[model samples]
Target: MSATIVRRSAIMTAAVAASALFLASCSSGGSSDPSDSATGSDSASAPTGVTLVMWHQSADADPQLNLYKAYEAASGNTIELVDLPADTYTTAVQTKWATGDRPDILEYVPTPQDMRQLNMSENMLDLSDLAFVGNRVNDAGELDGAVYGAVLGPLSSFGMFYNKDVLDAAGVDVPTSYGDLMTSCDAVTASGADMVNIGGGSEFPVNMFAGFAYMADYNEGDQWGQGVADGSIKVNDPEGPIVASLTTMKDLVDAGCVNSDAATATFQDSIAAVYDGSSALTILPSDFISLFYEAGGGDTATVDETIGFGPISAEKGIGSYSASPIGSYFVPSTGDATKEAAAKDFIDWITTEGYQDYVDEAQAVPTLTNATTPDLGGLYASLADVLMDPSTTPAFNQSVPGFGSFGQVSVSVLVGQASPQEAADTWQAYVDQAIEAQQ
Candidate 1:
């Protein structure tokens, strides 16, 4: 953020006048400063007059839309965007793909299990050789060690959100651990605010609570994830964290720390409760920081002083890490070499010289070592700090082989249809089925 320089990486590009595309080849160490210019044959250049058809979720707006325009202006290319509803984007992509419909590029989830619907190895380009892949990302857009999607944005961190005034008025410090959390519930109730809010009606938030506790207990959950991936770590284990987490949920409810309408409340309702000072906290991803402030109808400048986000765990200040929040660009195989190379050029441009432009515009945390990080104040700054957590574990879905939801079962616990142990058993059944299908 301190320096302003145009980014120009060494991407060797030759104009294909007839096809109206540039075949750009990039070296790993190309300069990101565009002002430095393309100096060598190994350097890459922005494509000229290439028109790319791209698809993005409808929820994607603002700086995202502007970022694409910036790329078109800087690279002399036209990107025709197709917006699909976020809830149905993946299903629509798959349905269309079944009929041989494919876009030149797509904004999609980068995980292997979630993205497998597209048949990536056979249909998508392997982006391992892209200049930024070696450093800027770990598993954001990777599958089997190769990068498929270009993740040129901030990684989403998982944790709890609290109203600063709510907690302070209750005369309680931020709870360090779940055990620490329990002790403060009485004071929070005395202050006349619900201790926490949940949207079990949506199912995801209920599972999020369980997952938060699981991640804290096993930081860097690679070994446990591997167990789940291979079907050895059964979700039904009587002593598993799933059972414990649900038991904790019941205890909190019995203690009057949670809202009466928890099972019927939606995620939006929970955020509204915290914003209206009806509740003290809600467990959710940091990406939703804007919604809480928006829900309150308060000025944006007061977000930092009014709201705070932190890790919710068995241990204090250590939380879960989920890469799913980091949406990435995936280029499908078009069988046109010229257009294909142009796609790479576009990806190269955004993560390099054009990245700072977006960081300034979107106020995003820079994912790359080379890119300067601006002061991301408010809850965002706290979320950014979570990325630096050395012992953070991957989100539960990280190792799962396909689209599976722990929430699908955990919701039963909230409704009292199943006990914690029973819910775990049902989830384990689903996990076993998914792992077998993989083989």
Candidate 2:
């Protein structure tokens, strides 16, 4: 999930036209920079007054909220913040759109399905004019050649989070390959502990593994993805790489490499195992480094030294990783032009140097080129090298569709309700169906 820029070629002509229409309908008409003196000045000094409404679903909202307030104060505009609960944000937004009462600006992750559903090319603001969203060498949120949203910052790479104390006590080297991991599982379990704590109740992790497998076995620029997109690849295609990946995951469970209670555990519970020293590893994002340190009741310094990270190792060749933008702000097709302008201003300000500085200070990565590194107690710095080269190790979870189903598959495989082959088959089936629906 490391945020590396990716270059995609132009889409078909039909896609381009559709995108153009979508952009036109959603156009809010304003400069991409919110902090421009002309846009931020008081009404007495500026051309007109504007009001904006924004919706966001991140767990950490205070920093953004305060930042928004400052933007409003400085720009002399009225800005309203709508904080949606994480679980319901998707449904809520859909409902708003269905009711024809969309927010002026909203945050969304632009998955392929999302692109198809929103027809975003014709229904969202064209952010290509913005420096942060447009200037990146690889623009991730673009769909069908029309950029919909701006990424918040660099992508966070996902990998196995291990407890050094547990691994050391078990005499297992940090695993560098799938074979090594399988061998380490035996020693970990012989120590009377679970090798990995998995949250089977959730679906995201299982889907992540499926995606990772696809990336690990194939080159990033290959036709596997296009095949999936165009209905040429079957989820249960007998000869597909998905089956092998699922088999590996199944092998892990069959060999007692993961917690037996994984099927019923919630995400928090699984993560708690690592913090409490009951398990050796948990697949998660780099941001979790901060959370783990805080949860262990240790200061940043202690956590930085104690935690270690590396890419997911492969048996032979390198592995590719997947990542998505932190959700982005999108202006709707039906908002008032003035409000839309205001909304765009807010987006511009948030991605600017002033806001990125705040993000850096908060220890979060910034998307802008001039972004300053946050003082994250050296946790991020420790893993910086690994994060940058994730694709060279194990595949990331982003390359797959239906990423939400990861946990369910993990649970099924762990509990023996499904064999590795069966799980892989089911996952591929689901992904194939999803891809078809989008098409």
Candidate 3:
């Protein structure tokens, strides 16, 4: 299945009820730059000599650990950083919360459902009124007009990662729009290489198509997203965005831009196909630059020399947009006042002048205007420009509920089990059912 589908399962797994636990503990981790003075309320104080516990998934090697250690030494309050394993972090956090043991600070992705479950507006400390709030690009952590979380560092964009060597060898330019993509695909294919490795067995292609479709209708997504949330929008509607998106998917497939083994290939298989020089492109998030490198199991320098990322819109003239996650941080109100204040101060420090360092460490686009990112050459540089654009929107699937079903519907369309319209309608039915159940 697609990473979206898999991640959704990861969200709901253990049980729908158990998902409550997962949401309660969801967040992101980051590294910090200590040279710049932290900016925020100086009055926000921690209990002297107290060891504040923080639950996060940031690796030990991240510079944030050192920064926190510095905070501990300077303030005389110990920050006991708990590095939760990726697979069990959600469960562990939820279990701790269930047992009435909550961390002082939480690093998570603040999805709508999770926000509701946590009663975020009421329970999480309101960061909206803080001076640090001014550094944010948008209120991604806002729920019902109250900002409950701090989005750590930067935004990660989704796009196609190309094997630069292969594209160069085939005389293919990096695709900037859908038309360019098709032309590039044709050129690459004519050169006897797979145009792109589509992990059709997974929801990956659907993910890319969703990015394209979402960019096409981005300005209207919030309205339709609310409609979906309230049962007014259905995927199967004749003129719905869902149907339009599915049609785009079909067109890409019919154009013969996809690999022949797409219907059977897994994500890892697609990644390997590109690494071995059999394919030119694979749609993925920017962070996957490292993942692709690690997957290759080679020296980092060699991988950096081979791969790059670029944008692809649904049409010829429009600039491409990709969905990005605003990694969120929260200070739970369940803790004591001293702990809460310290957590707030820690988070506030993260948004200050040196925030760019954390973002660079994460290989993401900085959320702060003053922050700088490393110069990633080639297609990745192009994608970074798109990300820096003020008009860009978050990915649609991430914004709308019930969007995960598109992956399965996409698979059906690929296998001839359903037409694009049929797939759209099926997804609509699923959305309708979900809406009714919520009612």
Candidate 4:
């Protein structure tokens, strides 16, 4: 579902490319100028058939699309949805922004890393003081204590999802840290299975390799970005999370603690490796439960029975909430006073008055205090447990601007091409570069 989770563009060229794509897409959808700058009130006017341009990817669920229709019917406001192509959505958005074009409302990944690209602090309407803020299950879109994105449904957190039966058979308690994980490799290998399956080939989950360690910090890494930004923290610190985590990865490789085909393994392979009992565990997001569903013939019963979820950390069981903001919506600082107010009203109404209906429409596990969690399954329950954990905090990628690149070199740790220190050094270079660019 993710891919733009990072990608930079050739500013001028992408802007040119975006012009044709934007026009073509807008012609078929509803056309609106994103550069509207008639600033006025921050409050919504009574419904008068105002059309709000909403930019979303094709992956926007039918429930959400239908919800928009329901919203229009109730409020008499027209939501002109623009379905941008998922692959180029971020770059296209960036390009549109480069040319001073923006949507009234936009759906995005809602990560500090991603938000940094959008300059959310300067560009997005703050949702911190909204009435429903207290009801939110997690702070998915908060940066520097300011909330900017509202995640209405769906949740994800990353960790080492293990096969309970396999780990139990291996006589391994859920290891508290990567070092603790290594102490059980002998027991795990003796049980005739690999220790963990790093899905290196997909390259998507690689970030979690080192991120788990950073996220498990004392403050759950909420201040990680601030540290890096203010030059108080260094990515390449020899004793830091990056080197320590990556070194453990290399040690796992040497200790025969990973799958034989770990280098080429995909997410599917990692799922099967653990679920089919070929490996004890895999490092992935809570959504691995969804993939395991496919492996088990779409059976939630099988998924719940065989799989187990636990938070991963460097030296403790502490974890971070890493949910993808699927139903999250961001209102741009579009400067059209009327549209801005309507956008705020939409957020307020959906999260308050229309919330129950919204939850029912998505069949989502309740992430609000007012709603009750439905009977999705044991797997869904586990996913929600980690997502709503009181101790967990937003991940580094969720707090640090441009922090996505910090973990970009983690796959090299998996393939043994870079030593832990080397990986950390590379990350430090990226951090320095990002800080310079931001400054």
Candidate 5:
């Protein structure tokens, strides 16, 4: 897939609330009860055949469509696939849901409040009984002990992926600390290359900086989420590490470390810049290594020998790299038992060991603990140590409040529109606002 499509898919998973609101009428009522609600239970009275209408963003449509076909062929059920452009996915889902036209199975990104706000917790089938989904739903995707969604893909880590050739050509070792990373920018630039290529126009890339910084500084497992929940941690707190990270980014810009055009570059363009040798490294998702191979014309053998992956910084004792589960699938609470059963069955089949193998073969990673990592060609084969390191954690972008806006603020820092300090402060304010709004 193109970088733009990848980014859009990630955004769709993260910002389900924003898009849901625009696409459908908000339902205000008590949250649906998974134990006793009509939307929650399976029908015992009759054998009813159901057509499960499913919706997913374009980036996911291809794989999911194939999976659904497998599901139908195996189970003898009809599944209607609705593939919408990633840009329009949220709007379309909301519109369909608002008009009282609901899909039996829906795949979208979810925030904590989405279930209650959209009444999906009440309207979609609850999959708590399914072994695969029942195992993965934490507080992040659940509310009040009920799960509304199932994580569908492999967990992903976010960090700097370097073109080994570029780094080697510049005589710079892969950085092990933030200080080294900042210092190496000049050496990279001196070699007629930019140090990093980030797509600031997209929110997720910017959010990654905050997530990485938080992981770097905080040791408490899930402390970032706790801070947001308790109003103790703010995204922009001048006293916090995220601000320092932002400042460092600003310092790089001042030093001409990143591409001058980075602030406005689309994700695809930025990836292209790295591929064509205009830049040395880029902050990328774990799947990027595989994407890199594809972009180089699917010559895995040729690509495997050249790429490397590492944590977001070289700052030892600070933090390890982290990843979050993005673009998961969820079954909404619906009033029909037959439909609910079918939904759960479909989810179970997809996340099963057999299907996970297919996913690993197709997508390079499987989210389930039972699945094996696919052969990621050569560019990423070298970074296996970094990607699977026990020390790595999930990035806060998937969990932190108000982190979605980090990209815009980072862009401002890069373009001199906002001082790093101001950007940090703004982020904290956003966190505070989000906490209050959620409460």
Candidate 6:
């Protein structure tokens, strides 16, 4: 077998960690009174033979998809899976809701705007008290003290990923502070290689800003979205912490430490650059490490041994890193009791014992500490440690509502289309629009 196929097969086997056992029922079929109003027990009153229309974007090979089929077969309930296109899925879902043809369950990125767009607070079944909520590592979709969403994949963090062999060859010690990082970048470049493989073609520049801002938040001990909530600060202050954070990325650009083809390189391309030893470092979320391994044709051991993960920092030197939610599933309160109960049952089942299998199959970080970790090894394992830290805070984009504009504005600054101040002003407008949308 080809090495790539071997690795792909390994990934698939890992994701299918264990065969899933169909739960007792997808419906609340017991004789319990139907209108009990208790969250967990509602399943007992769900009717059998009810078809749940699940609208989602999970891949055909996703382990959860198989589990969906298992639940259907075991409980005699039906799951009408409507797979949607990724780029237009959210808009399509909104259309369905507007036209009164929404699905019972929804799959989305779980961003604040996405949640609000679905009328989450008003329409989703609250999973706050589910057994799995207690095992969660972070508070993501919790709003007004209610858990409205469940993750379909593992939680992950964004930070700096470095190639130890490359850095060592350049005699650059792992950077401890933002200034040290700049110095290291210069040294790595001077060694005749790219210092950081920042793929600027898409929203990576936004990720760059976010990485620095996350470090700043850790250094200053201020939560990223707290200012918006308490009215103490605005995200768009030209001189604010967020915009100020971009100065580091801009300096890197000026210093020629960023890959010259960054403007056109995709994130996977950058990962490949690092894997090929053409670059010493890159900024990305921990989840993308799988691609780094894949680019090496499944040479998991060499990839893990050569690369290292560390938190990017300001003066505080690794005060914290940011945790972002991934694979969020929501049970929209479709106002149909049977469907709602079935949705709850399905969500609840996935998050239970079957969750580990899902995590294994997906090769994602388990939100529950008790779940087994996939054998990703090396930098991924190291980054996973940081993600498990109690001091970890939510990423700025995840914490702040309507924060997609931050990425767009950051892109303009990276490309020299806007000054930092101009970008901040533009970001402020987005923030204002976001707030207005919430209202």
RMSD of each: 9.1, 8.7, 10.2, 12.3, 11.5, 10.2
Cα deviation in Å at residue 402, candidate 2?
5.3
Per-candidate TM-scores read 0.82, 0.78, 0.71, 0.73, 0.77, 0.77
- In model 6, what are the clashing residue pairs, if there are any? 15-360, 15-361, 28-43, 28-44, 28-46, 123-333, 152-327
Model 1 gets an lDDT of 0.68
lDDT of 6 at 98: 84
- Provide the lDDT at 212 for model 6: 44
* Cα lDDT of model 5 by residue, 87-125, tens digit: 344556667878887677787765453444456556766
Q: Which portions of model 1 miss their true places by more than 4 Å?
A: 1-51, 84-101, 219-221, 296-298, 336-339
Candidate 6 per-residue lDDT over residues 1-439, each given as its tens digit: 5322332233233323311111111133322232221222224664568799888753333455765765665456788988875324556677878887778877765645466666777788899867778766545566666888886555555667778888998998977566776788767887787987877775653555344424435422334465664446677666666666677667777888778887677676777787777988777766566667666677878887887777665564442433233356788887788778777777776676356556656655555543555544576557655554434444555446656566667777677788777777787777777777677
Q: Please provide, for model 2 over 145-258, each residue's C-alpha lDDT reduced to its tens digit, 9 standing for 90 to 100.
A: 777776664345556667787889899997756677788988888887788777665545454444453345453453465555555765456566656666666788778787
224 in model 5: Cα distance from truth in Å? 2.4
Q: Model 6 — which ten-residue stretch has the worst lDDT?
A: 17-26
Measured with C-alpha atoms, the lDDT of residue 146 in candidate 2 is 74
lDDT tens per residue, model 4, 1-439 = 1211211112112223433444564566632222221122224554447899988866565557776876676677889988775434566677777898888888787766677788888999998878777876555666667888887766556677788888899998876578777888999899998888877766665666667533566333456656777789887889776677777778888889888787777777888888898888887766455567768886878777888777778776766655454577889998898888788777776666556555544545544544433434466666555554555555666545455555458877777788888888887787777778877
User: Which residue pairs collide in model 3, if any?
Assistant: 2-203, 26-108, 27-107, 27-108, 27-109, 28-107, 28-108, 31-64, 309-379, 323-395
Across 1-439, the per-residue lDDT of candidate 3 in tens digits comes to 5333333232223123322322442432223343554432244453457677887764323445655665565455677877775323445566676776677877655656445545676567888766666655545566777777776534445567778888998897877556676778777888777876777765655566554433533432344556667766665777776666566656667888778887888766777878777888877555345557666684666766787665555553323333232245788886588787777666666665435555555554555444544434444455556565434444655445555466777778776688878887888777676556545
C-alpha RMSD (angstroms) for model 6 = 10.2
Clashes in candidate 6: how many? 7
Predicted structure with the largest TM-score when compared to the true one: 1
Q: Which window of 10 residues has the lowest lDDT sum in candidate 4?
A: 3-12
Of the pair 2 and 6, which is ahead by TM-score? Answer: 2
